[model samples]
Target: MRIRLTDVAKGRRDEALPPTSLAYASGEARLALAETEQRPTVLGLIASGRMAPDVGTVTIDGRADAATLRRAVALVDAPDVCDPAPNVTVAGMVAEELMFAGRPSNPVSARRWLEAEGFGAIARTPVADVSPRERVALLLGLTALRPGVEGMVLVSPDRHGGHPAEWWELAESFADRGFAMLVVAGEAAAIVLEGRAPRADAAAGTGTAAEELDDLVAGSGGETPAALDSDLVDDSEAEPATATAGDVAADPAARDGSAPASAAEPAPEPAPAPTTDPAPARSGEHDPIPESADPDPTPEPDDRDEPEGDR
Candidate 1:
């Protein structure tokens, strides 16, 4: 069996998931990077044919049949969709999953199943308290039991806080058992896995799995999708680019630009006034009356007329 997603996307332009394309066939495990709280689940849904992509296609064996795809693929532990409740006990979860698989679901049966599956000690433990590695193994094991399930989309196992290699090995084991596996994880997990690929390849003595893993990481461009980084989106909207003081001062056109100085840049300082010396005082002439000082109100008597009358 083969499953392919061609530019599959969900939500408004870059809201939930960016357009992505990937394909995996039976006996192959692939990883896809999806950050943010909603993206992993969204990708898992689209990959498993549980949800339709807003702008792409998902095909099984080169046929676009949602019903058959849904039947053949299982979406495991998707947040807010099929995840076992945090408060639910391991025994309870096991029993429920057993019932879904059309097997005996009584408490005794659940216990026996747990013991047989090497999870007997954790039977009474709350699912939330289960270790990440054990939790993933148990969930994936149970998912494999479901009838008609040939492939699985495991969603956001990294969120549970285990090393990527732990769960990745489990996925690879399932794939080696002829099940197509797709693990939807965050960018951090993908980076860790990519970094460990060389060591893993050496340990396995065959580079096939590591090479395929490298291809998966490379296909994602090894970077967080712009849409998936909510913080970046929020920051761009919260703080717009503005002209700096240096920019306004250096570019005369910026000062005269349509954007107001108060809005786009700081106002420039006022230029100093030009200085000039007053015309040299005229020779032997009283200094030109000060432009600003007021003249005395009392007037002087005419000295020539008064003296002539007395003589």
Candidate 2:
């Protein structure tokens, strides 16, 4: 998906531009970093992973870089990023460098070491008088003291002017030797790489490109009235139906094809009166039958054989 960086930075991060991709989504820092100039160092550090991004993830190759890059990559800022000892000569310091390197003993011979490292005459001079590059070289040399330094980064190198060809050729050689580089340049830089700009007509045409999916399907006779189902549900709760056949017959849609949704089924008439014999009634409320209706006149003999109720 193509995320709108502007909206994300302004609406989410609040940064002007993103420091590394992470800060781009920061709801606050983004508002401050959007300019072509006047950027903060934390932004660069965030990109390098020494600091954190406010929004997106940082990756190298395909793996996340925030963890790995912080240790592997070093940033080079031009000139004077250190302090010096006044009591010691350059050679004395270079000889004692082994102590600072965690060796602390069995130091290099100063006279022989100074000559071997191309600082023989200058070795006797105090470090405070040396050029920035000399100090940088000292700092850079210490990186290798760690025993497994694979590479280094130099921001502004000496050979960038009339010697551009030679310097770039050296960079090409370094790349061939598998050194990853990040070179920064000043205003007077002479080297150039060719690039092409997109044609105006092509870009404009693409920008105005239209979508016909909805319109084409709509006009293709599928989304028209004929394509719509008449049986589809209507809005609102249906009322308990009291409608009869005459009311159902008056609906135009029902006449055309649709059914009358609220029409009720016709009520059935009472069944014809059932035929049965008339039943006779009792004379008194408490009596079962009148004595006059007795058909069996004779009485059966009592079971006990005691005549009448004399006892």
Candidate 3:
């Protein structure tokens, strides 16, 4: 808990400094929207013990060393930083993460923990089968299980399903558990942190003060011109066949010498074809007329069988 970054700057030496400066305390969830390429580097450096901020200080509980910070912070489900292989099972991912974090890496223990957390249904299933939202949730839960993990920095958790607010809610839940939570994403997700909207000053956009990197990333170098009505004419109206010289001369307007100065008089629309009624069918064409069920035209009355003499 109690993570702070004072004028922190991190990025490749050849490139410009990343906009990663800010101070954040425990029980607070902040959103950092860094450039796509630089995002992973910044999150990885903060989570891992590899690199420290170039410009200022990164202190957790008043300690600034990489080893101490690494033990305290965890990065969850960040493919660019550290993600389990697609084929890895849920249990396998947990075991791997625990092992790297210097915690218990027992697969059986990991599986039991996952089952206890209601992941038993997908414990054996591959991580790829898990939905994005479920996967992020599982990963965050796994990060929390790591020994001495006091803080978590989620990279692009909003890339999964559900609204960004939901993701922020999940992060806030972690902060409630006495862990410092920081979420980084491509854009500022609508979040109500600490019962209030994100402060205007808290936003450290991916770009520097002099330039807005969003414009570059969004592929808008400058203001785009609006299209004119003529530029947007329907294809059906604009694609009429060109009039031949003979046809042009035969136009009624051309004959009367009243045609416009332009040689291209609009082609007259073709007249609608007249419709003819279908011919009537003969009486016995293909089907046979239905006949009466009884065929006898004349029937003699039956004599009483009992009276031979009378017959």
Candidate 4:
């Protein structure tokens, strides 16, 4: 099964929802790791017809409609979404669900279903009494009873406190039976997808399907697949150089509507200043005057007898 989400924006980032855009190609078991509470778990709900995306389209196998999506998607053990009453007995919950769905409502039939799934021992136990992992497993077992479900979305399986590998195995088991699985988990989740590969276009806008889906759930804007592809292309090519305000003000070429050289030429060094002799100090000065400053005033060329005596 293929699920694609286009420019979908929802919820407020300030309130823990960020705008997002992305495309997701589903695997047998896929993992959506999110840093925030908004995750693919919400998308699973939208896909299953429980909630509507504020914007954008949710298509399964290239079709979008309530009846089709509802029939094909199922939520398993999603806390606060699909989880049954904690105090409800396993058999009791199953019987009620079957009755609501217009299926066999007999508690005995529900009990038989549990036994067939190797959960007979917990048939009479209240869900709250079971371990978190067991609770999730039982919920999954119940989900299997729904007819014609082609996809299962498991939300925050890590909250149940078990190896992510265990959840992966469970998802794969469902996939082996031809069901597509999506596991929404935290960054630390231990999920392992079979045949998982890095998307070549990962550099494209939208970080992950979960983040983009949250963007939709948070009521943000969404983009079509084509627009997203274009964004990827734009990102790959280097962006044209842009001058900052200071640069533009400083560069004459920028002001003249012409591109300046990619690299600016270094400025020429300044010439050294000329040296000058200082004036001689006056006779009454207190500070000592240097000999160069005084310069012997041309020695008052004593043309007198001193010249004859020395000669």
User: lDDT winner among the candidates?
Assistant: 1
Q: Which stretches of candidate 1 lie over 4 Å from their true place?
A: 195-311
Whole-model lDDT, candidate 2?
A: 0.40
- Model 2 poorest ten-residue lDDT run: 23-32
Candidate 3 structure quality by residue, lDDT tens digits, 1-311: 44556565665662434545543445666665555655555655654455666667665544566777677777666656576788988888878866765777798878877888888888888987887667877778877877887877777665655566667777778878887777766543534333443531264333242232222322232432233224435543777655577976878876676754554667778775455853454453433324755645675654433344431
- Model 3 has a clash total of 0
Question: By TM-score, who's the top model here?
Answer: 1
Where in model 3 is the C-alpha error above 4 Å? 12-17, 47-49, 98-107, 188-311
Tens digit of lDDT per residue, candidate 2, span 1-311?
00011112211354533422321111111111222332333333444445444555444323444555545544444233213475567777766654545653233466565677677777778876765556545545543343332333333433223433333344344334443433333223322311221111122123211212222233344352433333222311354545566866887876677766543567678675445842443342222346678745575755644444422
After superposition on all C-alphas, the RMSD of every candidate to the true structure, in Å, is: 20.4, 27.3, 28.5, 17.7
Candidates ranked by TM-score? 1, 4, 3, 2
Worst 10-residue lDDT window for candidate 4 reads 197-206
Q: What C-alpha lDDT values do all the predictions have?
A: 0.81, 0.40, 0.62, 0.62
Per-residue lDDT tens digits of candidate 4, residues 142-191?
67667777777777777767666666677767766777676667756632
Q: What does candidate 1 score on TM?
A: 0.63
Better of 2 and 3 by lDDT: 3
Please give the distance, in angstroms, between residue 196's alpha carbon in candidate 4 and its true position after superposition.
Answer: 7.3
Q: In model 2, how large is the Cα lDDT of residue 75?
A: 44
